[model samples]
Target: MERILVVGVTGAGKSTLARALSGRLDLPYRDMDALYYTGREWAVNDDLVATVSRLADEPRWIVDSLGYPEVRDLLWDRADTVVWLDYPRHVVMPRVLRRSVRRTVTREVLFGGNRETWSDWLSRHHPAWWAWTQHTSRGREIAHRAADPRFAPLSTVRLRHPRDTAAWLAAL
Candidate 1:
């Protein structure tokens, strides 16, 4: 489907799946983090809403995010399909931990030219910590959004495990 939103809690691999779907479906792929974090030091793009709204108007796109507060409803409203990664904490925690460790150790550059540092692990914003703390809440939020009447007619593909997602993607 076009105008897809790949959504999940932190570390659920939303970006990875979205990228894969973009290639498979031949739709433009947009990483929300890249769009939101526009410069060094994670400087936020001041025109995020305007920029995202413009993208939402496009005929075909696959974005990896639940969307930032300002654009959450807009993305959901415009999306024809939503791919939800609903893996359990057992599956999510290890992924986030490994990703954070790898990024920190390799000094891998991420959105806005920012790299995860050992010190960054102390922050609540760190992926590992954020995922651990917000896992349940995020799942609830996603569930509510999926069930919301306002977003009706939006086709949803909810994957409960990594294997399920793999099979679904293969079929797609």
Candidate 2:
């Protein structure tokens, strides 16, 4: 599987897995978040389509977190493998919370010059909150998409634990 899509709920280590896969497969890695969030605009921009198409032109790549239907189809449709990091709700929610708190406290820059703030951290839309809310939601989302004929030919793997993910990545 050359072109791979590493998908999961927020704070489920999607970017971490994507980087590991890129190294294991000797392919380039791209963070979909960087393309989706441009500091100039808070919302998704038009450049996303071009970036996705351009990246797909490469023979091998690992993309982390793609959710927009068009963007999802572009990568998911062409990706040879879909590795979902389906960690437990308890594990991910805590991790996301910790990460968010640390980032907000440190004013860490993320995704194209954007920085997490205390206000954002407290907001309902914070990724930490999203990680919690979207926990079981992803399974439901994936189930329907997995059933679609468009994804019939895909090589799918949903890893529930870090050990399985590590072993799979190491085997790659």
Candidate 3:
């Protein structure tokens, strides 16, 4: 699919799926985290909206991002297809926790040169905690978006399991 928008909770593998799709389809990929972050901080780029609008106008691209309100409408308006990774909490919590631990242990640099720390991991704002708290709410939001008549022109794919995601990608 062209102009794909991948959305999900923190650990639902949105980035992974977007990257895979980009590679398979020979399309460019953008991770919204990288666009939203600056060196070690969450600073919005002054040109963020315009930049994304420009990308959205492209013929083909894969964008991976959480459904942040600021740019949600902009991206969704341009996306021909939306991929929602709707894996359950039981399936995603461990994935997020392990990812957090691994990133912290390995000192992997994330977007904006930020690295995960044990202290941050324990914080309420941690990705894992965010995922746990927002899981159901996020699912409801995606469902609402899918059912909205305004988005009628868009095709939405909701994957409820990891295996389902794999199969969808394979079929693609």
Candidate 4:
């Protein structure tokens, strides 16, 4: 699929799947986090909307996100295919937790040159907490988007579990 958007809850492995799809399809891959966060301490790109708009105008791309608020609708409107990783909370929570813990333990550098800290785990914005708290709501949001008439041209692939996603990707 061209002009793809890989969407899901915070820990649903959207980035991973998007990368795989990009490689498989020979499409350009873009990580929303890398584009949104541009500096240290998680500083954001002020021109994110404009930047994303430009990217969306391109002929092909695989963006790993439903997108942040400001650019979400634009991306959705431009996307021809949406790969939704709708894994349940049981799957998402452990993933987010393990990812956060590993990042903190290793002091791994992330987008914007930021690193996850044990202290960051206490923050509401932390991926683990966000995934846990927003799991159901995020699922509802994605469902609504998938059914919306405004995005009628879009073809959606909703994967309910990791195994389903694995098999789907393998087939692709």
Best by lDDT: 1
RMSD in angstroms between candidate 4 and the native structure over all alpha carbons: 0.7
Whole-model lDDT, model 3:
0.87
What TM-score, to 2 decimals, does candidate 4 have?
0.98
Clashing pairs in 2: none
Q: Which stretches of candidate 4 lie over 4 Å from their true place?
A: none
lDDT string, candidate 4, 29-148, tens digits: 999999999999899999999999999999999999999999999999999999999998888888988898999999999999999998898999999888988888988999999999
Off by over 4 Å in 2: 40-43
The true-versus-predicted C-alpha distance at residue 127 of model 4, in Å, is 0.5
* 1-172: candidate 1 lDDT, tens digit per residue: 9899999889999999999999999999999999999999889999999999999999999999999998999999999999999989999999999999999999999999999999999999999999989899988998999989899899989999999999999998
Comparison by lDDT, 1 against 3, better one: 1
Worst 10 residues of 3 by lDDT: 36-45
Model 3, position 111, has a per-residue lDDT of 78
RMSD of 3: 1.3
For candidate 3, the clash count comes to 0
Give each model's clash number.
0, 0, 0, 0
The reply for model 1, stretches above 4 Å from the true place, is: none
Worst 10 residues of 1 by lDDT: 134-143
- lDDT for model 2, please: 0.81
RMSD of 2: 1.6
Write down the lDDT of every candidate, Cα atoms only: 0.94, 0.81, 0.87, 0.94
Per-residue alpha-carbon lDDT of model 3 for 80-130, expressed as tens digits? Answer: 889999999999999999999999999999877888888897778899999
